[model samples]
Target: MRVGLFIPCYINAVFPQVGIASNKLLKSLGVDVDYPEDQTCCGQPMGNAGFENEAVSLAKRFDEKFKDYDYIVGPSASCVVFVRDNYGRLRIQPNHQCVSEGKIYEICEFIHDVVKPTHLKAKFPHKVSLQNSCHGVRLLHLSSCSEQNVPYFNKMRDLLTMVEGCEVAEPERPDECCGFGGMFSIEEKAVSVQMAHDKVQRHLATGAEYITGADSSCLMSQNGIIASEKLPLKTIHIVEILAAGL
Candidate 1:
């Protein structure tokens, strides 16, 4: 399993630890991992903002960077969604080849479905509210909602159950947007904050010590509001908890 790790721009800048943990976890499971320095943003931010034309160059760059890897695993679901969904629109010939040849996997999905760790050493006593990233839930369908009549899409829950003391809770309205839709946070600050506030309120009501999700952007959005309001909730990436051991 020659896996190339794709660290999103936000994770690369702010939560590099998540990327590190992901690499360590994968290697610990006996998979060969590689991080290509030439890789940068997956052009998700620009594509989400209707700037597909502007994103072409970045997409081309990313395509060339990791085209040979068997699988490109990313820590952020949104970034994976960006490449999985929009890489075909890059218009460049090599970009198309890259998308066709390389398999993109979000870290949780890879762990739950592909790697399937036999012995998880992670133990987290905190009850966690599962904040499903919009792209992962709505776009990539990484995990299924109970509202939907699907049976095979609960990979996130399956992985969480493997952790020793971790409990997963769903919000009042499962799969609601956390409002960190890339540039939406900047362009629609008021609405973005309100949505994040609502999400945090729901998480708080669950009485969870930590809110956890596969997407850091959604966690970051909720964490900011929780911090400003001085709430007792802390946000964590799912991998961070999974990497822990009691």
Candidate 2:
């Protein structure tokens, strides 16, 4: 399948390694992946901040750029959630052609549910604390929660288990937010830090060497606290762990 890779602005700038690892992982699985250099933000920052006008402009730009692809995949759950959930709200005329022609997927969801790399050569011998990105968990319902009876969120855990020596640990509250809601950190620095601190504390309490998640933004927020406190935890994107074999 031909897929267009959309690396969000933050991932492109701060966590470029995750994008590179994602590309390598997909190609290793024999999927034809295309990187549209012109692709940009999905306008989630503005949309989450109540500036739909600004978000619409960026969303229009995104729709125009990736309109031809069969699938638009990315590493950031937040960005993917924005595109999947808000692209329809763009003020511009809906590119029905693109909407009908292309699909948006978070990399982990795509791999665990769609690609299903049954025999990965990857191995990570570390206890990993899984932090659920708010958009992915609460908004997309990517993970199974007690609130939902059917249990749908084990995709990440299942994929991780395939890696030899990798053990996934559940946090005290698996579905809590990391408080890295883009501008929410800066707008409410004190509360944001406190939330992040709590999340990191839970992970550290688990004695996990690495804290892994689908969103780098959340990891980055937690990393700040871990660094300041000199915690023995490292943060990684799920793709980075999967790409370890390569």
Candidate 3:
């Protein structure tokens, strides 16, 4: 199946390696993946910032860009889930069919559910605390939500386990939000900072050398705190870890 890679704006500007690793990982799995050069923001920022109308054109543009692909996969769960769940409400084109609505998926979700690879060539010898970004856990169901009584399953954790020498650990609060809710952090600065502080301390408590997750957005925010406090931790996207040594 043909796949289109959707790199979120923040990841493109900041953690470009994550996008590169995502492409490399998918290609190594023998998937036909292509990057749409003209693609831009998925409008998740504007939509989450209380400006849904501004995201309409972006939603339409995203739909047009990847409509032909069998699946549109991105590294960020929040952006993918936004398109999957909110595009229908954007009223773009025919309004009857949002081509990308059902096809878009977070990279980890696509790999775990669709590619179903049993092993990877990746090997990273380090302990990493898995950061279950809210969107990935709650919206995309990338992992079992702590608040729910579902059978425990963590797609990210499973993927990381494939990397030889890599040890995956979870913070005390496995699925807590890192307070990087797109615009939620900007609007609720105080609350967001406190939440991030709490989240980071828990990850540190796990004695992990690195904090890894499917969403780079959350990592970016936590990295800010780590940098400011000079904490003994680093943030790496799960794709980068899964693509290690490859």
Candidate 4:
């Protein structure tokens, strides 16, 4: 199947390597992937900022850009969740709703649910703690969250272990929010810092050398605290780890 890679605006400007690695990882898995040059922000920022009307054109533009592809995959679960949750509310566009639905997937979700690769050639040997982004766990239903009584299953954790020598650890609170709710962090800096501080400390408690997660947005926020506190921890995007293994 043909796939279109949707890189979030911040990731494109800041963590371009995540996008590059995502492309490489998908390609190594024998999937046909393309970067739609016309793609822009998924409008998640604006929509989350209480400006749903302003994100309409972006939603429409997004639909226009990836509508023809068999699948649209992005490295971010939050942005993908935004599209799935908010894109349909903008009635200015037709029900070109696949952009808002199953046709789009977070990278790990696609890898586990669609590609279904039983084996991989990736290997990264390190003790890593998983920071499950809220959108990935709560919104996209990527795995069995700590709050849910479902059977133990983590599509992302399972996929990350394919890297030889890589050990995935769990934080004290498995599925807590990173507090980078787009505008929420800015508007609630005090609460955000406290939440992030607690999360980082718990990850550190796991004796993990690196903190990894599916969403780079969360990594970016937590890494800020990691750097400011002079901690020995480092943040890694899952795609980067996956790409390294390949």
Candidate 5:
């Protein structure tokens, strides 16, 4: 099946390698992948900033961009979830179905659920703490929420397990927010930094050399703290980790 690679604006600008790795990983799995170069933001930033009207045009543009693909996959869970949840509200088209009845999926979800590869050629010989971002855990159901008394299942961990020499661990509070709530980080700078600091400490306590997750925004938040304080930790996208040694 054909898959459209949807790279979010932040990822495209700040972390281009994640996009590259995602493409390579998908290709290595023998999946036909195409990246629409003209793609812009999924309008998540605008919608999260209390300026949703400004995001309507972007939603329309995004929907038009990848409408024909069999599946739209992206590395960021938040962006993918935003498109899935809000596209109907934007109603760019007449009686629009949001993301065409959820045609879009986070890369890990797509790989784990749809591609269902029994093996991978990737090799990352490092211990990594998995960051279950809010959108990934609560909304996308990538993993079981901690508050719920349900059987535990982690799609990110399941995918990473296929990689050789990769040790995946989780923080004590696995699904806590990293405080990069788009505009919330800026509006509540002090609170955001505090939350990030706490999150970083918890991640480090796992004795992982790197923090990896499906969402770069959370890793970006913790990376800021790790960098400023010179912590012996690094942030790498889960896509990068999975694409390693390919």
Candidate 6:
């Protein structure tokens, strides 16, 4: 099927490789992926800052750019959720509402829900821990939450385990926020840094060589701390691992 890849603005500027892996992995699974070159942020930062007027303009732009696609898929759950959740508040046109309401997907959830592939040609032999982004867990519902007391099922881990020799481990607090709430990180640097450091400590306690997650925002947040502190653990987007096996 033809799919439009939505690479968040931050990922476009700083973590483009994650977008590459997402595109390559989807194509490997027979998806025809097209990236709308004019795409920018999904307007999450603006909306979160109470700038709905500004956000609506960008959301309309996004709708115009991507509404005709078969599906909109991306590596960042937060961005996907932003479009799904806030586009309505922007009073998106009736004809265009469905684009935000239904046809979008975060990469891993897309694999599990849409592709539904039980096997893959990819393989990554490594000890890796999963970092659950807040938007991914709470908004996108990427995986089961620990606080829910429900059956433990992680769609992200499902794909990770499919990699030929990948070993997935969970942190003590699997779905806790990594503290990178976009503007929240900037306005509250101390709390954000502390939250990220605590998350790194839990991931490192797993003794894994790499820390992987579906959201680049979280990985990028922890990576800053890891680099500054000279931590041995490394961070990577989950799509990178899923693509590595191919």
lDDT of each: 0.82, 0.84, 0.92, 0.87, 0.91, 0.88
Task: Please report the TM-score between candidate 3 and the true structure.
Answer: 0.98
Error of 5 at 21 (Å): 0.3
Q: Residue by residue across 1-246, what tens digits does model 1's lDDT show? A: 798888888898999889888887787778899999967787777787888898888888887787778888989887887787777757657433555234888998888778888667778887998888877887667778656787645667778888888888878876889888878899999999999999999999998999988998899999999989999999998888887752
Tens digits of per-residue lDDT, candidate 5, 137-156, equal: 99999999989999999999
**Residue pairs in clash, model 5:** none
Models 1 onward score TM values of: 0.92, 0.93, 0.98, 0.96, 0.97, 0.96
> Which tens-of-lDDT digit does each residue in 1-246 have in candidate 2?
888898999889899999999999899889899998877778888888888888877777788788787788899888888888767756455545436123899888888777877877688888999988877776656687756677455677877888888989978888888888888899999999999999999988888999998999999999999999998899999889988878
Off by over 4 Å in 4: 95-100
Task: Give all candidate RMSDs, comma-separated.
Answer: 2.0, 1.8, 0.9, 1.3, 1.0, 1.3
Which tens-of-lDDT digit does each residue in 137-170 have in candidate 4? 9889887787667898888888977787889998
lDDT order of candidates, best first? 3, 5, 6, 4, 2, 1
* Total backbone collisions for each predicted model: 1, 2, 0, 4, 0, 2
TM-score of 5: 0.97
What would the per-residue lDDT of candidate 3 be over residues 1-246, giving only the tens digit for each residue? 999999999899988999999999999999999999989999988888789999999999999899899999999988898999999988876648789998988999999999999999999999999999998998999999978888999999999989999998999979989998877788899999888989999999999999999888899899989999999999999999999988
Tell me how candidate 2 scores on lDDT. 0.84
> In model 6, which regions exceed 4 Å deviation?
94-98
> After aligning candidate 6 to the native by TM-score, how far in Å is the CA of 17 from where it should be?
0.6
